[model samples]
Target: MSVQLRHYFRLLSSTTMKSCRSNKLLANNFIIDFNGFYRNMSTVAEVVRPTDPNLPVEIMDVEEYRRMNGIECFGNSVADPIKTFDTYRWHPNLYRRIKEIGYQTTTPIQAQSLPIVFDKRDIVGIASSGSGKTLSFVLPALMRCMTSKQDLWPRCLILTPSRELTHQIEKVIKSFRFVRSICLYGGVSYEVQEMLLNKANPHIVISTPSRLETIFQKGITKLDNVDYVVVDEADLMLKSGQQSSFAHIMNNLPKKRQTLMFSATWPPSVQKLAEQYLDNYIRVNVSQTQSLSSLTVNKNIEQIVKVVKESEKEDKLLEVMNELVPSVTGFIKTIIFVRSKRTANRLVKFLKKESFPARAFHSSKHQEERDYIIREFRKGVIPILVATDVASRGLDFINVKFVINYDFPSQMEDYIHRIGRTGRYKETGKALTFFTAKNIYHKSNLIELLKETKQTIDKNLIDLTEESEDNIIKDDNNNNNDKDSGYESSGEGNDLDNDEDESSSSEWTSDDESTNKTKKL
Candidate 1:
């Protein structure tokens, strides 16, 4: 057999034979038969056509492509724009898989980052959640395996922060059916994972950093042959305190391999991690603003904050839930986030008692239970999900119209991630945060974020800040001395009036009145 044909046969045989030791001779004989069959058919005419018949024939203009696709290319000598998957020159099987998945147009992140990744260059893609970041890396990894004519041994390693996300990525990879991939995470029997690794000999391994590190340390898996490493939601991984594991995993991998780091926000910690590992990596920012804080939350979301007494939280949440359900369109899919597992459980119990279909998701839950909850949530079987920060990072819950922060996050980064549960995939959604005086530390940051998003902020919430309090005292003193100051003597009347006007102008007029108005008058 020729060198190329021999290598192709070896790869095909390895993929077909799950057990390397027992089926070695069988795989060799099968490959030999396949090679003979291929040689017999080599005389036939080769047919080449576009992967998708509906694909445009001509290359789209660079400027027009950028505008149409919302692409922003940033790198040293970035490649030409890839308007569609067909233009990327992927293997025919991979192209067919893409078409089968019903993806005609590339998302902004996919359009810009795919070229750099396909070029085997490291990249840091800063795009919002549900912006198709998974496929941006998955496709390139699959294509890398497809073009190669060698037996695969976990050439691509994708590390995510959560098991939910790891499973999601594995699901997408499996959909292609061109490569073998396995999901590795905690809360499962290590022996099972080891068995699968030895038997499947997957081309790609999707896993959490800690679990993958454990598997590496146990000698069940090795990164010696890995050519591509992808860290999805890198910020979340670092925040979840997996930085050391991430570093250890990278340290063990071959230094010459391609690395792709993607996150909704590139905080300083994530940046430091990237600099330590990624060499001359291209940075792709899909957000309108270059600032990481502004890019953290999706601008498509409408953020609403309510400052209430601690005792009123439950009642307020019940009010919100009641309003969200029993509507003409049916109940809205919602995810309520809290800071701790205890809170999540308590909230779920209360919600259930209130006749809402609710479930609590946290690290304490078994992997199977969490997986089931996620699936049900995605299928819209459970409209209300109360979860901790564990659910914030990478799990894509489709059609989540509302995200409620029952407990304000300790950091602005967490707040951004919590709100990101909604407004995904460019869909307009609402994020309602229940703020209390106990969460004073996050008050200023929350106000700044609201202002940045151009959302109307409740003065009560903003005025609770020390700086705003000082301003309030100054205005009160001026009003007390001068009757014509316009600030009412009580001050509450003017503030209440302003709040009414703001709420009326911001929410009621724009949404409710426009949609429900009987007449223009």
Candidate 2:
């Protein structure tokens, strides 16, 4: 071994022997020992760790590779050519809005999707999260509406799977300043949604399927003038949530209207929805390696997974959280997703009792509560949010760096949405998930997805020991996990720390007995 390598081994030995940082011992039994530290100090070049003989090894010291190649941040100005709004030939009002929002250049998805929509062509855009996919459709929709004859009801309709996503899309659309748009979803007053829809007579409207279904049933005239239709998170719609609402809306839409579907992953359901609504649509996929590829993040955070017993999951999560707090000193923001609302609420309660500023979201949170929590989360008042499939789908919050999967989804696609909440908007984020023995069946499908994305799981993290193979069984099961049995194949973190005592933590108190049964917004 080189002298430098010998010195590093000595450092490792002292650290390990002192019992600092690492809670568990190294997997290999051999402890680093300094054999020749003084004489050959200048000769040491590289240090390598002993491999776990049983598991397959993947050597990916990306930082070292980058350094060796003299690659200093390739994604800076040199890699991406910037484009101004004037280059797109946008309307003056829309151009002003885009500039105001600091949108100097069009992202690849936006660049490709904008023109097709502007030309009145039906489109299917497949892009990774945070690729400015929303703006791609929103800009064209608003510009077209603002320039055209203003319809009393909305001329354009955007449908998102969750209330959070509906609100997010609406927020982006509303930035047009000159354009009028309304966001409709459950948990808020029907009168509120109705009044906004009626009084604003918005040129564009974004909503969830549930609320839109109600609007249509209540003789809302807005449905008739909606010449442009957008189905966001069509995969989520097809997977676990209600498809009837979308079907009803499609049945009611004017046959001549243009349609657009955008999603990170297009499973069979999205394809079916596209066939039902989109006509001769042009497809635009911007993900570098398709669905399973994770977007790049700043190298500060490291992602790893732990395989545990299903029954011990809660205990393991608690242990990991305690271990993470001190290691990551700052008040780091985190997002955690559980498979069911019951489990989500339970976890939130546990965190609250542990004195963590955490909240749970699902179909169960009332409109006002959901609204308050999401706003608080965005404002950083609530540092951590525990959620069900609703938060998993398409909610965008870029500052989130740490995400944890308390319960692995029965379907692998949901796993993608969960991790996607972090590592967004060109920022670095870390994700740690707990995969239990029960989830062993999903190993193959998940591995296939990773392979498709030209990526591989960290062998150190995934324990692929089970030999028995069984496919994930599909069921009619939706949100309640009580709705139907089997697997609703459709849709859809790290830690540091050691300051607070676990048993004495404070808990969040709620007085509202009325539950938000199917609240989406």
Per-residue lDDT for 109 in model 1? 85
TM-score of each: 0.77, 0.70
In model 2, where do residues sit more than 4 Å from their true spots? 1-84, 150-152, 288-303, 325-330, 450-463, 466-521
Q: Candidate 1: how large is its RMSD?
A: 15.4
Encode model 2's per-residue lDDT on 350-369: one tens digit a residue. 87788777777666445556
* Candidate 1: C-alpha lDDT: 0.70
| Per-residue lDDT of 167 in model 2 | 76
Overlapping backbone residue pairs in candidate 2 total: 19
The per-prediction CA RMSD against the true structure, in angstroms, equals: 15.4, 19.4
Give me the displacement of residue 215 in model 2, in angstroms. 2.0
Model 1 scores a TM of 0.77
| Candidate of highest lDDT | 1
Model 1: lDDT of residue 226: 94
